[model samples]
Target: MERTGTMKTSKKMMHCFLWVLALSLIPSAFNGCGGGGGGGTSDAPKQSNNSEITVSSNQINFGSLVANQTADNSFTIQNTGTRNLVIGQISTSGAPFEIVAGSDHCSNRTLLPNQSGTIIVRFTPTANAVYTGSFVIPSNDPDESSLTVNLSGVGQGLNVTINRVDSSVPGNIRMIVSVTDANGDAVANLPNTAFTVFEEGEHKPTIVVSNADVHPVSAVLALDNSGSFWASRLEVQNSAKTFLDQLRNSDEVAVIKFAQVIQLAADFTQLTSAAEINNLKAAIDAPYTDSINATLLFDAVYNSVDRLILRNPNNRLAIIVVTDGQDYDASTLLPGSTHTLDEVIAHAQQAGVFIFTIGLGADMHTAVARRMANETGGEYLYPPTPAGLNAIYTKISQILINQYEITFNTTKLVGTLNNLHVIVDDGTMQGDDAISVTY
Candidate 1:
């Protein structure tokens, strides 16, 4: 009975030990499904998806357009990342450059990953010149927040400025002519065949052409300071000042105020790199006290022409006269008005001076103004009101500020090296180009 009791006690001890072992394994069994087997979450934070943007091209060129004419070009934008891209706005900085929203599919729009949108741009220039600008696309791309595109174009037009004729050696005369596109850019590589020299009803027996773009200009800005002008004196002053600011270095200017009297407001002041443009503008403001009622338009023209002849005998010369009425000095015997319209025209032609006429009001002698400008190979402009004067001045300054002189010695530059200035304006655009040689 003792032996049987010993075996039973041993079996009971074994059963209790097994129970404890099984309990310890229960925790490990739970851990086995979520630990080394790799079936559980990590303690680190999750990563979010990101977006990226790309542009097909960073540059867009319009090539060329006539002044006031427009052209368009397009570029592509794409979302190349894992997430969507949101473009907020499209903007530009500069004149003549703008977005063509009607054809633009990208601005203020959302794009899915791997999707692309197109943006169209337009260029329209108001003047003949080289235009530069840039447009920017603002977006929600993490890598690329904004995309910038550069824009460029040129404007074309035609102009011919002439008759800075120098004849110090009798008939051995050399005349300067500036041939430019409507945008006022110089035309190059033109032969003497481009010009015709007519003296009174006669063509010259000889002609020659050369590049004289560097020849200095002696100009006269004859402004109206009469009673009619009193109504717009401040506007006139500001406009005249703006005109002086446009002149190139080495250009000499003389200001004259015309009314019943022809008074010299400023002497020939040479504008240079060192001189302030305001100094010239101040001269225009200082001379205006108020003007007399009489308009001595012709006498003023005569005086300006005569002064140019006396001062710059062998240089490029011009007389820019702004008047509101006809030559009252021709009709009346005024102290300050002595020269007649016929006398002024004759003297201007003899001196090889160009007379640019600007007619102000309805009382302007249109025939006289036209004659002065046309006869002297200068442009004639009629500004509807005084407010348009600054723009008119700018147009005139563009011509005079850039001129070329082609010399002729009694008839022939035959077989000699000559400059060829090419200018073209088909109304939509204007352009000029040239190459030079000895004349």
Candidate 2:
């Protein structure tokens, strides 16, 4: 009986060993047949069922950009996956670099398998410097959940401003041109011959002189302290003060405040001393106790031009009008009205007085201001906000100081109203501005 039992136990052991060997071989068989062997390993890489993201470029170079100017570029994003790919938030890291609006196709969007889209980026440099930033893109990519595109650019410093100055000489037209670097500093090294002037009928300048040699200026500040500007009175005062501070000591300024009536706050006075400038600021900041019933816009401008023409006909004459409303006094029902638009424009042209108008708010008549400026060879500026007034005033002051006075004897030119065109070229840069003269 003991021998029989030992033989049976040995047979049982052999059966157990065979069963274990068979289980191992079964997995190998399934793997070789490409079956679903959950516990088996393969030498080949496993294919993922999730989405994958790819980009056309990893970096963007904008090269060089001018301060306050904008440049743009674009890139493509693709989905190489069997399943749908979803893109999430997209953002830029720097102040100047920005993702252009309506240009990002992947933001909060879904892309089907093998689909692609484009994204546009823009750069606007406010100052001169090397700018660096990145665009961060988040997506449901298995390998890369987030992607970054490096951005780089350099800002250049160069800007040119031109303004016309009134001249009493028959056929003589003057221009105040300034070249500023990125830092807003004047560049004085440019030669006088760099300027090329053109008349309406002719292609060349009669005569051009770079006023790099300083000259005196006669300017008038025609301010509207009317009801419309009451709320922004402080801003107007500050802007006027800032304008005065920027003028040269040799420049003469006059102040005219117009509301229901025009008041000569300060007569034509030379801003040669700090006390004179302070007195002018005080006059500007003075209370507007007068009634704000009407705005004597055209009349005020006419009177200011008359004041400038009477005081200094030989120097560069300019009238800067700051107003927030149109000429309501022209209705004939109002009092203290003296001149019409046509009269003002005629007087300005005859006297060679340039009119620079600054319309403060949307309520101001842009067309009238633009006409006045265009007729007298001046500029019209409408600042979007009160904060921009100071900058505009500073720019005008710079133009006044760094002007190019062009004088040519027009004995042959015969006309009461002559068309004048001026061109300045420094080989690389050029500027063209026009004016009308009554000789």
For lDDT, the strongest prediction is 2
Off by over 4 Å in 1: 1-162, 170-172, 180-210, 273-276, 329-336, 411-439
* Count of clashing residue pairs in every prediction: 21, 1
What TM-score does model 2 achieve against the real structure? Answer: 0.57
Per-residue lDDT of candidate 1, residues 199-220 (tens digit): 4334554656565546677889
Candidates in order have lDDT scores of: 0.71, 0.75
Residue-wise C-alpha lDDT for candidate 2, range 1-439, written one tens digit per residue = 9999999999999999999999989877877778654473556577679888889888989866557666678889988987888999889896789988898888898989899989889988876578999988899997888999999986655544444444445555555555555444455556767666555577554465756336688899988887778788788778988999998888889888988878888887898999999888888877766677778888899888878768645577889998763777434646445677889988887776778788797687766887787677666667888888998898678766765666665543445666666554556544445555545
Off by over 4 Å in 2: 1-189, 203-206, 329-338, 409-418, 436-438
Worst 10 residues of 1 by lDDT: 430-439
Name the candidate that leads on TM-score: 2
Candidate 2, lDDT over the whole model: 0.75
